[model samples]
Target: MKIDGSALIAARQKLRANFPGRGEIGSPSIGTQEWLAEQAHVSIRALQYLERGEGSLSNLKKVCTALGISQWQQLIINYGEDYVSCIANRFVDFRPSIYPPENPETFANSSLLMTLDPLTLLVAKGKFETILLQEVNATLTGLAEPITYTWLAEVSLTPNGQGWLGWVKEVEPMNLLANDVPMNVPIMFKQLCVPQVSWGAFVDAVENLTTSQLNIEVCLIFQNFTKKFKVYVSVDLLKILFNEGRNKYLSPLPYRAQLKAIV
Candidate 1:
């Protein structure tokens, strides 16, 4: 499998520029190759090979992790869309369902209740559905702890012409589905609020992009993470959720072209 060394180098350089000081995990300054190699646990030689487009995919992934590049697929510039599709189909999975969990009381104490009405309206009107990424791991670049982030990605289309809207809210496994959720699940206990701007742009892209694009930019929202980074999601996965959601829910009103948020 061929790699795009230029793309890899660009991403690495961008990370170095964005984070210029010493990194966590006892690593050296982020600007140096040796520091990156240490963070990725790859030999400096292997890193060099990768920058030249000659390393294995395993090494590429490690480099991606160290560079804060959540999805290695973003670095594969020469690999055509088909390659991305193949990878997306094989690895990405979407678990879609209705929002406002069956147990509403569990979230009664949550401070986000006020912002949920728009979501509730969509669900009640059969216009909203959520996709859960299950367990996603993310670490703040300067922080020591690597948190397992779990999100319930809320999605809804805006009338037909207005495009789509979305919000990714943090969920606590215990309060989320305490009764049926297993203890071994990777859902986080801490709730970090997602910024409106971040998730808004994500769904907006989804609405405008073609399936060939395959990947969508997703934000990793952490309370203390100063820098905002992205996680690439397979567009196909979201399509799966949309298809399933549309078929699962039936609206009673005559199909209207216009939909409005309950503000």
Candidate 2:
């Protein structure tokens, strides 16, 4: 979706509102611009242009680096509502520039790659799938470790079709029954298997399987599931996912014990 001009204006207003006494909308640190310019080896005018939102992407990156900020998303959030949607949209489809010297290659495997686009669509549509495919892609790509493994117990839908049936079929050799009811005659069951299935694994599986097919609808499901079972998954995974959305979804303190155990 296109970034609205009015939203940009509102964003600027919000930034200005945050520092009513400053006589200008800019970073809170006094002389921060000059300091950043000096550290980045850029002219003070260029740094001023950035603070005024008139600087180019290169200058902005340099200033952000000099200021010790790793991602621009934080700055965007600080800008407020006008940039919120735009930032959210970007988060969903973020593909880091390979040409940028500081860009990390590992970033390509982040949940951000999948969550951003579908999430933006979800914001626009207000409905999205429960599963996110990009998460699955990352797992499949071996960026993160698996959480669990389980045998596929059943399947009854058309092969390769969308919906639950498609999901079951993809991991076939398993039987998906409507319920635990037994048929008049005993039915034979095949052994279908899924490996590395954790909350992350499940999310990644659903995401990788249905990203193009399901889009934002998948993210809605993912968001709901994550909230419901926050305690079930590793805190690090939760942090990673939240970071992808450019939001803090988990409490860092609560996970200290768990992280210690994992380490």
- Model 2 lDDT tens row, 180-209: 232221111121123312222334443344
lDDT of 1 by residue, 167-224 (tens): 3334432211212212222121222435211222333344455653232122322111
Candidate 2 regions off by >4 Å?
1-31, 73-263
**lDDT (Cα) of model 1:** 0.39
Query: Alpha-carbon error at 23 in model 2, in Å?
Result: 21
Error of 1 at 253 (Å): 55
> What does the lDDT read for residue 36 in candidate 1?
71
| Per-residue error (Å), model 2, residue 21 | 18
List clashing residue pairs in candidate 1.
Answer: none
lDDT (Cα) of model 2: 0.30
